[model samples]
Target: MRNLEQVLAHAENHCENNGSRLTIKRKQVLTGLLISDKALSAYELIDFCKGEFGETLQPMSMYRILDFLNNQDLVHKLNLANKYVACEYINCNHEHLVSQFLICVECQSVKEINISKTVMTELQRNVLQVGFHLVRPQLEMNCICDACITSQA
Candidate 1:
């Protein structure tokens, strides 16, 4: 529960304030992601739950749960890979600048990193100058991880 304690508590608090609740199924879906080695697509998560826990949840059900978690910032979606990863900064109460993702193309591993404030500021300025509002900007880069690179060599 090292990763889930803070997340579940924050979710409970947020739901309490919003008149919603984090159901058991939702929590289970989140737990799947928390223990995953790589970002998981909706179908992959469905398979994981069934294989790991003998529970079969419909794809639609998982999708809805994912959407809610995403809205709560408890998870992040990698558009390039069409997968989701649990947010690494959920325990931090303080605000974060920009979040960047480094995804291993070969093994599908994902690492979330925060962009420097200076760079984020300049990037925001550029976007604003172009008259496009950047909402929750996430940069995803595709690369081979060290393990994969080493294994290849």
Candidate 2:
């Protein structure tokens, strides 16, 4: 878990660097996502916002906030689960792009790994050889972690 105030401050810096404004609603939604270790669906986020902000927010408003956060690379949407999680690292300089994720099946924890330059180049070459163009390259793999395995035994 992260300090909510620190998360907000970091988010504010991110917005300033990107020349975007972190509106109150966006901050609320982002902070809620940050505090959660697991991914949350849109509806869950709406409920969190209502509980925190004391006002019912529309689905459209939530979607807009999500879209903005995604575009700015502040949050990631897991296609498999149809949920969202705040980026593990917030100060990344790279353009907002899809990322590969490793999910621990037992704990439901997620880790993002950057696509190495060599791997990306090789993938592009192989795809071109097959007369295919790659669009989104995020790969989600399920595996058991050491702690889970040990605890299970």
Candidate 3:
């Protein structure tokens, strides 16, 4: 994983290249996600901003920021947990592959993994065979994280 400064710089460059601006609040929100060890909901982000950056963010505003970040692919929304995490590939210059999330059901920790093109092709084929078009190729799988499992044991 890239350092926070490098990731943020990469995100800034990426946004500028896309003809969009990464505003201060957006940076703050992205920073919160990058620093967090787990995915965070908008409310948690609001709290993070208030506590960490001494900034007060309204829920609607926070959602908009999250939406912008998601659109930029600088962050990803984990639908299974209804939370968001910073994109792990922010510092990478290559195009992204199909991404899957391993979400810890017990602790809500998330890990992003890339699926091989061959596997993604097979999955898409299966989807098409069922007469359903695969819209978002991202997958979110629920599981227990190592820490959670060890605690249970």
Candidate 4:
């Protein structure tokens, strides 16, 4: 609960600074994401809102909210799994160097990682060599988690 409050507070401050309004509905969506252990799709978020808050959020509305959250740097969209996760480093805006997502192919679990600056520079340089610019340097890697691999074995 305390953690949620802190996240909420940070979000509020961020919204204020960025000239954006974090409405109650947006907060509700963010709360759902924060409480979930795994990345959640928009439909999953809608179900969660209905189940937990007794409110129904339409898919279109959810998409708008997700877009706002992503713009605010409060959420990340995992392309591999087509799900959203609240940014783990919510309080530190400066710490966002390059976010790497390690996704478990079997269970859709995601782990956020930061590679060293040297590595990030190298990656950017390589992309430039190929005539591509990285708007945001994020790498999504697909792998089976240890638990999944062990279970399979």
lDDT of 1 by residue, 4-31 (tens): 6777787667666667777877777788
- Note the residue pairs that clash in candidate 3: none
lDDT (CA) per prediction: 0.86, 0.81, 0.94, 0.89
Q: Cα deviation of 124 in candidate 4 (Å)?
A: 1.0
TM-score per candidate: 0.89, 0.81, 0.96, 0.92
- For each of the candidates, give the backbone clash count: 0, 0, 0, 0
- Winner of 1 and 4 under TM-score: 4
Order of candidates by lDDT, top first? 3, 4, 1, 2
Best by TM-score: 3
lDDT of 2 at 146: 75
| 1 versus 3: better lDDT goes to | 3
Ranking by TM-score: 3, 4, 1, 2
Error of 4 at 10 (Å): 1.2
Q: Which candidate is the best by lDDT?
A: 3
Model 4, residue 93: displacement in angstroms? 4.7
Which of the two, 1 or 2, has more lDDT?
Answer: 1
Q: CA shift at 71, candidate 1, in angstroms?
A: 0.5
Report the candidate with higher lDDT, 3 versus 4.
Answer: 3
